[model samples]
Target: MTGPGLRREVRAGWSLFRRDMLKFRRERARIVSSLLQPIMFLGIFGLGLKNVLGGTGPFQELDYIQYIFPGVIGINVLGISMSTGVTIVADREFGFLREVLVAPISRLTIALGKVASGVATAMFQVAILLLLSPLLGLTPGFVQIVLLMSAVALLAIATSALGVLMASRIRSVESFQYVFQFMLFPLFFLSGAFFVLDRVPPWIAFIANLNPLTYAIDLFRHILYGDIELGELSRSLLLVNSPAEDILIIAVISVVLLSASVVSFVRME
Candidate 1:
């Protein structure tokens, strides 16, 4: 993996990355729709529930908007990263994917480049959300924001890999959309984004523990809520896993999914 061969592979991956970013930039409607859903959840739903959750128990005295802010960000990243698979289907339909598959580069490099592009797009959306955090009453410190973004980048890698895996053999955009929606809603809802894991039934909690986004959202909470004062019950309800455990789980999942995506891409026609 050295010499001119290595250099050529790098260039190929870079080309793919650049082309995807440019395509994403040109899709203004996609950019707006991607950011819009999360904002609505954070604003309308959070505020609506703020009063309802104020009375007692774990949610007592909780600032619902501030509490679910990280969760909204998690859902945003989840949807955007996993939806990158849709682009692969589009490329396939237009024969662009076939052209790339025949190119002189390892499938590993191609997969990595695609995952990187998806991660870049998801993070771009996250940066916008972070900028609007203050308006949403979440004034995280500069250091906290940096750490949170870094954590989220790791999460994005795994999710984008999953997207690549999903799109690997699918040839139709219509089929991809149906499958994407089927998985997207369950993953987002079960990830503890809109509800507390502790409040769910044992069976549901068991299922959530298996979700990668669960760990990612918990990791986000650790970074974003580090400075905020929270009650014991609130902490219990929010931080599902310790930061160290969350990192370990997400890192392993990312490695496994990345490897799987590369294998799937290589096997694709």
Candidate 2:
């Protein structure tokens, strides 16, 4: 007979996942609020920058909206991933995490449930953006669809693990907010989400290569446009040869971070 422990773990995991899903559904306003930032960047920033490109072929005709669209997608995922981290800290603060920890369930099961909630949230945000893509002149084909989603899934999981790992050690949510603010914007700009990497100086380019978000954006760009150049003046900025290579590197990072999160939870007990 299967032990009661096994059943308890599964039940707890499902309950946690369902709770988050319901919470996400209830907060419908967040969907609109979250999208506004990306839209603003595309509209205000991109429109202003598009005029200066001198209409180059390598830029796909210097249509700035198309160049920055994938980065906008990154913004959506990063915003949700970070918010999920806040919820984890809130649970710890409010005694909900204590209640869950005391129960007869494996810590891995709980961690996976938490990670799943973050991943689901990101995908929901992505779905909204995918529907809006045509308005920006991005029409992903079937294969591109698969590639795009696969990249999003891998990146989402990695980011969730990172957030969870951070939350695990930090006792207070306020501290996390401080640290997160420092890390988040740097990652966004360093990822080349808003601009082509070609014009960036050598020092900045070197630092960007070390950021995981850089590879994630590379995968997004490759899959979305299929070897097309977002800027004519720039050489190929990809660190990896293909989207598959990018996915592989990110998968490794995800596994490492997920393992670290599991270990952190175990240590917390």
Most TM-score-accurate candidate: 1
Best by lDDT: 1
lDDT of 2 by residue, 1-269 (tens): 17887787788888988999998888889878887878888888678777775365445443567777888888778768766777889899888888888887788888888888888888888877888778877778888987787788888888888788888888788998888888888888988887767678888888877777778888888887763544433435432346677778888988998899878877774
| Quality of model 1 by C-alpha lDDT | 0.86
What is the C-alpha lDDT profile of model 1 across 1-269, one tens digit per residue?
98999999999999999998998999999999989998899878788987887555656645778778888888888889888888888988988887998887898898889899889998999999998877766678989988898888999999999999989977799998898888888888888887787768888888788888899989998998777778887788778788999999999999999889989988887
lDDT of each: 0.86, 0.78
Q: Which regions of candidate 2 are displaced past 4 Å?
A: 1-7, 54-57, 60-62, 227-240
Could you tell me how far off, in angstroms, the CA of residue 82 lies in candidate 2 after the best superposition? 2.7
| Model 1 alpha-carbon miss at residue 147, Å | 0.8
